[model samples]
Target chain A: MSALDSVPTAVSRPELRAGEMLAEGGEGRVYELVGRPGTLYKAYRRPAQLAPLEALIAWEARLAEAQPELAARVRAATAWPQAVVTQPGAAGGTAAGLLLPRAPRRFAVRHRDGTSRLATLSYLTADPGQRAAAYGLALPAPVSADRIGIVYALARVLEAFQRAAPPVGHGDLSTRNILWSLERGPEVFLLDCDSCERYSPDGEALDSGHRRRAMTPNWDDPATPAGANPTLASDRYSLGLIFLRVVGAAHFPLQRRQRDSELLSIDFAIPPAARRTRSLLDGAVVWSVCARSLSTRDPARRPAAAEWVSALEEVLDGLGAMSAARAVWAAQGGGTPAPSPTRSAEQAADVRVRPVAMSGAGRRWERVRPPGPGLPALPQSTRPAPPAAAPTRTAAPAPLPAPPSIVELARTGLGRGGELWLGAHRATLASLSRAGRRRRATRQVIGCLVLDFALLAVIFYMCAMVAGVLLGI
Target chain B: MVNVEERYAVFPFYLCLDASASMAGTPMESVNRQLPLLRAAVGEDPAVAEVIRFGVVTFDDVAHTTLPLSDLSLVEAVPTVVAAGRTSYAAAFDHLRQTIEDDYHASRGKGDRWYRPAVIFVSDGRPTDDRERWQSAHSRLTDTGWKRHPNILSFGFGDADPAVLAHVSECKPHRAFIAAEGAEPATVVPELLAGLIQSIVSSSASVYSGEAQLVPPEVPSMTPIPVDELD
Candidate 1:
């Protein structure tokens, strides 16, 4: 069966004014109407598989009435449900059509030459140079006075959104959703509004009231399912992605390959390089929002939109002050001032100033008063001078003697002999000093050894004599 | 001292989808089913419902704003998915650029400052039309002056070119592409959709308060069968 066979009837052919068909979409076909004043019209085709186009038409009309503000954002059709002739042999039914505003003639941002517009996906993909150029632009600038202002501006924007009455989430936030108008100066705009959701005014803080399953991959929370409810945290997730992209780190925390069935298994990790690129304040704000949004494997722990806003606001305020200071400093040619050692020294000395003594009993003090042309005369003291008080201080105790030095102890060296020889020498000296007493002790020992030896010798002699007698002679 | 009711928060998201002809098969169907599933999941969370907003853009022969920037609540009904078209990435890029520009202004006027939007572009084929247009538009949307660039993501299905999809997405490994291989949309859609939802939720939670430390998601290991093997 043909793709459109399920459609209730074939799309009716509209009269051609000799213009080309610029594009064809599922619901409708866009044609560039010919004439001196050309315009575009998207002719809606009635499909069988889908709901009737009339329902959509009616719904859009109602939406335009109910939310005029929103309707104003889109290029609303000037005329609706224009009838068209049906295909030959097909039932005679009118096809619906609407005239839409023509898109800009120059789609891409143009350079000064206007010849080369800004490179699109095709160019970047085809050329390495273009890719490099795009990356260079996407990467956040280094921390500098200029960057401080940018950070402040970003924070303020975040703060403003957080302070909304019923919190709002740009559910599918990304760089593609942001547009820059290079008129007079750079003006930014956000697009793709179909997925925006408003939190309940009476709901919990940052509570996303989304219950429908909705998201675009890589730019949204992987945990959120189709028909799932919306929450402010989900928007924060998209915002974090945008922040990463602007900083030139395009990939989400998980590698794209890793985003399959294991998405929940993946935890978000901010690259260290990204932190370096982001200002401390911006980094903190970004980190907090992302961390809270991605924190719980469960979505309950994520911070609400209001909470995110408040926290981010504080950071933004601080960033703003820093930026203002940096701006002033830059204006004063203080971009890179040389260090002054002398000034630092003087400040350090000032910081260490001692307190002046106020005791009246101490040494007389003479205050060095500033010199003035006319000095007020000192008032005469009416009180009588009191007698000088005795010194109220106790005398310190005398110092203790120092211990003997190692050199002095070393000087009392060992005697001529080592430890054993010294002992023997001492014994000899003692014996000589008391020769009589020492001789008596020595006699006792010598007598015992001599007597024993003599006895041994006598025994031997007696044995020899007895042997001689026995041999007798 | 602090009123709990006053502490409101909002979540912002942008979907960058690929509407190439190859996406005409089960990939697109799976994506369509998953889109509603994602919305339903978001709605389930009170916080997500209160603060989150969604937008969708489909790119095929041309980038068409199937739905402009609108609150998710406004989409009372789910959109049906129909596939049959060639891939013209340039048109998609142009549409993205235009949509973002318009939405930014609208948000500002409403006194609502927007978080940077995320874009999840899903495709199943290479850019059959002009490549220069897509590149030019991508560059302009993602350049310095426009700091809030969409976190462009590309997903490829069977027979889809990873190199081409990666080029369209801002994310890296530029080779970081997802494919259904030969799996039916019913099976692959849920997995792919679930992965996307999980990524957004985790990333948002991580940065909600300030730049809290982010944890990376763990993706399953799936050996992609070569195209030749797909028979």
Candidate 2:
């Protein structure tokens, strides 16, 4: 059965206008709507699969009236559905998807393979040291201020979302779904609101096909009911796991101790060897939140999203603003830092990185180990020790206020057709891209988008043609 | 503030196959079809895909890495194999040593955790290379360095030499297998592929939580070859 098909609230959308296709997901395809820049049309693969489109749109429409204060904040914080896009049945179309104001560019970063995905807090958390050093991957500078900034921003967004009139709930929350940008301090982008859970006519949870979204056997919250749909408490549990991934260890401390391998999760318990790094974040705010949320076997006992916001705010209060908190750590770094070289640094330098032959050289048996056992310990350097101190707190001299959002755009314009808006803050899009550079980047992105969509269209057409020939349609 | 550094870890799996003239025609055709099926089977399961990376290397006159580790997800079709030249064991071994060294560190640089790599070598004919170069490369590939070393499994079919294949399966005597000479290409190739997929999936399941030892799952129908007769 189609997902978005035949909802009781299934009203045809007039907003489904002509548009240039932009990108495609398994369930839906996205388009840049005609006459509308910075807005997209998501056409569902199985139009019926997007049944919740009406619910999300209706929920959002009610927000301005229900909670005026949070309406604007919620709108800015997420890629919530603004309107639904419909295709006429005469043209062989159904209830497709939504018309969403595109998330700003800065929310995404390019992967090694040149494709860009929404940048998430997980990117910063991965191989924080070596990956950062070797591949130029970035995370918040190993500073508490930067890390705390990420938590505070996310908590604020979650609080705003939960405080909505009906309390919007994202049924699936993975690191990939939450985008983080460290550029203008700490900013968050919560994506794919389409998959969020809403209530049916009977007020029963309307969660289906979500088992396929993001289920990790080792990492999924055990608190989730056997076959029941996602609940708000479960979202909190998942958030706690993300925090664990951010700060210290996993929900369970197990290793690949099978016949022979020891492939430890990055979130594996911090062994005594990693105690130094653990001490720095273990007793901190994230640790407390993670402990409380994860420790509870029951979801109801877990702290609410607003509580997380308050706790994080209190933590920030202890050190003051981001700059003041950073100053406290900087002062501590000045005192009793270890002499230049450590065993780990020397070991990292000693490690030999043989160059792969770009030509017809020694590239015989490229290794991709088969399924079997007996894994060895990962390199010591991959788990480098955290630095000891950054002074606790320092008073910060007040910084200048940001220029008007209009100036922010002229400084780096991001609209289509070279159009510029005053005071328009584009977060996910890189700020370095200026007038001409921004256009080039946008063109490059659009080029990739068009090629992929066109290819998909051709494949679908050919398949339909073949099916018609075979079935004599 | 804690620098909670997390390294992304991937398990490496390599298919080192002999692409000498003997493997031309049906055998090569069988591989072209089977390899893609194997990749699809493993990829359909998320647990295996997240942990195991895949690569392919074929040796005839020389060993060439036709696919890299990350190519597992990128490739839509199995690579085609063309038969020509003499099989060179040295080229395959030496290339493996160099590749393991380069790929291991580079991946680590990108913050991936390194697992003790698994290498499967299948030969349909005996190596025609000089012994000296073969020994040197063999030593490096089986150095037990853990970081650079690979857990090698060897397989033989047709007129292949069982002794040489045994040496390639460095860890133990049980890791080597030989397909029956009279076996049909279509059936044998698919069976071998099925076995390999099972090995990958089961081993990956163990990577995070299973109690089973990390032994290479034995290919079901293939016969165990004798390693004692090796020079």
lDDT scores in order:
0.43, 0.56
In candidate 1, position B12 carries an lDDT of 56
- Per-candidate DockQ values are 0.01, 0.05
Residue-wise C-alpha lDDT for candidate 2, range B35-98, written one tens digit per residue: 8787666643333555677777777776766566652433444556666668887778756766
Would you estimate the TM-scores of all the predictions? Answer: 0.31, 0.51
Clashes of 2: 43
User: Candidates' interface RMSDs, in order?
Assistant: 37.8, 19.5
The Cα error of candidate 1 at residue B205, in Å, is 2.2
Candidate 2 C-alpha lDDT tens digits along A175-242:
55677665555666677787666644333465455434443334444555435566666567666556
Tens-digit lDDT track of model 1 for B1-231: 111111122445666566565666667667766777776555333223334556667666655555455544334334544555677666566556657766776666654456666676666567665455455655655655665566665556655665566556544543245554664555655666687667655655544332322222222422232323221
Which residue ranges in model 2 land beyond 4 Å of their true spot?
A: A1-24, A49-51, A90-94, A110-117, A199-219, A225-228, A247-286, A320-473, B1-9, B15-58, B61-85, B88-231
Which tens-of-lDDT digit does each residue in A355-411 have in candidate 1?
121222211212112212112111110111111211221121112323657876665
Model 2 whole-model lDDT (C-alpha atoms): 0.56
